[model samples]
Target: MNKKQKKMLIRIAITAVMLIALAFLPLTGIWRLLAYVAAYLVIGYDILRKAGIGIIHGRAFDECFLMAIATLGAFFLAVWTKSGDYVEGISVMLFYQIGELFQSYAVGKSRRNISALMDIRPDYANIEKDGKLEQVDPDEVAVGSIIVVQPGEKVPLDGVVVSGNSTLNTSALTGESLPRDVAEGNEIISGCINMSGVLKIRTTKAFGESTVSKILDLVENASSRKSRSEAFISRFARIYTPAVCIGAVLLGVAVPLLRMAFGADAQWVDWVYRALTFLVVSCPCALVISIPLSFFAGIGGASKEGILIKGSNYLEALAATKVVVFDKTGTLTQGVFEVTAVHHNELDADKVLEYAALAECASSHPISKSLQKAYGKPIDRSRVTNVEEISGHGITATVDGHSVAAGNAKLMKKLGIEYHDCHCVGTIIHMAVDGAYAGHIVISDIVKPHSAEAIARLKKSGVSKTVMLTGDARRVAEQVAGELGVDEVRSELLPGDKVAEVEKLLAEKSPKTNLAFVGDGINDAPVLTRADIGIAMGAMGSDAAIEAADVVLMDDDPLQIAKAIRISRKCIGIVRQNIVFSLIVKFACLALTAAGITNMWAAIFADVGVMILAVLNAIRALRVHNL
Candidate 1:
């Protein structure tokens, strides 16, 4: 614990013991009053000091001031009436102290949530110097510099793999709850754990500019951006605190005057005493504090699961997200290309794949590697020469003095080759030797198995529209889109075209409706930025998408995107409940107090009772993991 927190606990314990001693002791007169004074000071010293400071700063009245006056009024009345009831007044201060401690505990718990999320931050970064390992600040590490990450260490920054490979636990960044395989030339993001195998990462972003740091910054500042409900509480407290103070004053003065004018015998002391009680009951501390506390806890809980919501306003909006649009390839599918099928006529399947692999050996495209992987044998790079790459089609060249070709239909057609038709739903690559059609090899990007379930959960979570946008051909995009049960499909879109589609959806939104776009995080950055809510699959997401998105899903799972929305919906629901519940009780209690049907004791119950209830309710935000 911090020094201040420890000190407060010590003071609170001493005050509790002293108050009990005063009540139980046989000592009377000076000693008993002195004990009462000690109890008051122990439990209320902070309140008194704060009230004094607030007064000096020209804020005439505050919760602290109201509390001090009300408790003192109880003490004076006890003295006037010759009753041993000063304990009631002092107990108010004691309970106020307990309440303060309770608040501190709750705040500390929420702060711990933020700390735990940031525990993913790495303490050291490895740098290579003269063939030796050197430790340095991540900030001093430049892009393209090689950094070594050991097993079980948090990735210090975003980078591409230059050497080695590992299974990275990206649960902290994306809520995927799984370890992903990383290899040479693969991109790795910050805030993920290097689960196994050592890796040499070529840094692509500075320490401060990394995805993890940006997430930390956003989560830290989320509470400062108040939701509409929270803002209302602030305005309500400002109006209510002062208005109650004025009412208390008028009650203490006007009642006595009215009795005197009527020549009726009435105890002015009783009325003034009650007025002080009214002020204590109307402090508004609980309403002002607990409402925001709920949202703070909610945001904290989301952060723990690798969902970084930018602000309470966005959190509230997420609960209301009606339509969710997703990009197909990197978002719903395993972005890594894999050879799914091999088709060949007049030749063996392995040979067709071997020729295709040789044709694409020198090219760096994912499809090339996919076909190369299907061969499952090392290529004779010596024979694979004259590798001519044709843009917008495929790769071509003379391999072993044979005119080998492999690519989409466009490429085969360009070579004046006749390609056989195929029924499979995928990219059809045709091969030919010396201008004669050999056969066609079909390759498809398979969807992630979890995509269907992810969509199902979004429906359960209250999303009405589930749309998919992709640059893939209509047949390919639709084939995958159908399996996922997507509500709508828009295929064959460039990055600019995706932005235009997002704008069109936004324009078509009903009042109070919001649109969210999920993407591979690079090509879809503009659309992510343009939507009502930009949610990036940060892990496997492009750097540009991470910057533009308001909410980040660290592990590149479509399931977490839906999970995040549910979390936001739950948080916003709690916020609404607290707002309506607190206001109803507050307005009811204040009306009763004004009518004088409620006594000072009743006012205290009304105030303290409402606070304890609200506090318990606010802590519900921490239970988001269970939800």
Candidate 2:
């Protein structure tokens, strides 16, 4: 327990002991009244002090005021009647304190869960200088600095591994139990734990711009951006509290006068007691506290699964999502090219790759990288000479005294060489050796393992349409869409085209149903911003994509999109439940209090008991791992 919780427990213990001791004592009259007063002060001194401050500050229509007035009036009534009923007055304060304790405890528990999820903030970053390790604040580490992460250490910043290999414990960051194996050249995100082996990393970003810092900032500020429901509750409390207080006062005076004029022996004190009871019943604590708490907990819970929601408004919007559009590269696909098939002459497939890899060795394009990767050997640059790149055509180079060309069909035609059409889908690079058609290489980007599953889950989750948009060839886009079960495919789209497509989708979508667009490239930023909800693949996503997107899937898992929607729906459901339940129970109890059918006991339940139940219900938003 925190210090405040411990202190509250001690206060509760002391008050319970005193109440028990009084029951056994033979005290009466002034002695009994003094004992009750002492118990009340012990358990409720803070509440009484706060009520006094509220009154002095002209904000006396709060729950503290109602509680103080009701309990104090009970004490004075017992004294005026000369009855030994001090225990009832003290019991009211004691029980109210107990309810407050329960609230504090519940709020604390929810805060701790969120705190644990955000515990990825590293205390220090280990920088290596002059062959020695130095511990420095993460903020002091500069980009391109070599940082050493030992076994079991949290990665302090975004970086690429320069040396060594290890398995990362990303459960805290991604909620995945599987450990990710990392090697040289692999990029590692901050907030993951280095489970084994030492790693030398070159920092790619400053601490402030790192993934961990961004997520922490997002989670911390999420609660400040309230949902529509939460805003309504705020406005409701403002109007409801003062309105009820004024009504109670008028009822207290007007009711007794009306009864007296009717020739009935109306007791002024009884009517006044009823007014106090009315004030207590109309506290509005449940609606005021639980609606926002539910949203806060939901955001925290989604963050545990590596989903960062920008605000409660987005979370609310996600619940109404009907159409989900996705970008092809880096969002649904691996976005990495590989030499899938090699079709060539009788010279041999390895020979074709050798010519292609050597001709493209001087280029840094993705196709060049795939050629080199397929070659699987370091190039002999000395053997390559007179290299010339034809823009949008191909690259021609003299390798080992032989002219070689590696590019598309246009390049072969420009060289006056007749090339055979591969006719197959994907990127076809036709190669020419010494002015003769040598062969072709097929490079394709493979879809992610979970891409199909993500689409399936979205369909199962009630998404009406799943569309894929990309700047790839029609055949390739159609092939990928078929494999992933995407409902529609739009290929060869420029950045501007993507935004236009998203706008069209928005127009086609049904009323009150939102359209979400998921993308993970710098070019995807415009479309991400244009859509109703933008989801970015956080791990490998460009900074522009992450910044423009409303939600981020930290590990770049497409499945998280559906999970995010599920979480948002659950949170909205809980909020509606709390609002309906609190309002219905409150108004019913308020009617009972005004009708004189319920006493101070029912009023306490209406104010504090309802709040406790609502708070417990709000905490349910945090239990989203199962969903």
Candidate 1 Cα deviation (angstroms), residue 527: 1.8
Residue-wise C-alpha lDDT for candidate 1, range 1-627, written one tens digit per residue = 667778888887887787777777886666666778778887787788988998899885778889988888888887777776667877787777767777778888888987888887778899878988888888888888999998988899999999998998877665557678999989888888998999999998998888777777777778788888788877887777889888888878888788888998667787787688778778787778787888898888888887778788878878789999998887898777777777666777787788888988887788888888888999899887788888888878777788888877888778888888788888788887656677877778878878999999999888889999988889888888789999999999987888888888888878697898887777776787788888887444356765777777766667887878878877777777777777788778777776677766777777777777788888888777756
Positional deviation of 300 in candidate 2, in angstroms? 1.3
Cα lDDT of candidate 2 equals 0.87
Provide the overall lDDT of each model, using Cα atoms, as 2-decimal numbers: 0.80, 0.87
Identify the leading candidate in terms of TM-score: 2
Task: Report the Cα lDDT for residue 46, model 2.
Answer: 90
Q: Give the TM-scores of the predictions, in the order they appear.
A: 0.92, 0.95
Going through the candidates in the order shown, the clash numbers are 4, 0
For lDDT, the strongest prediction is: 2
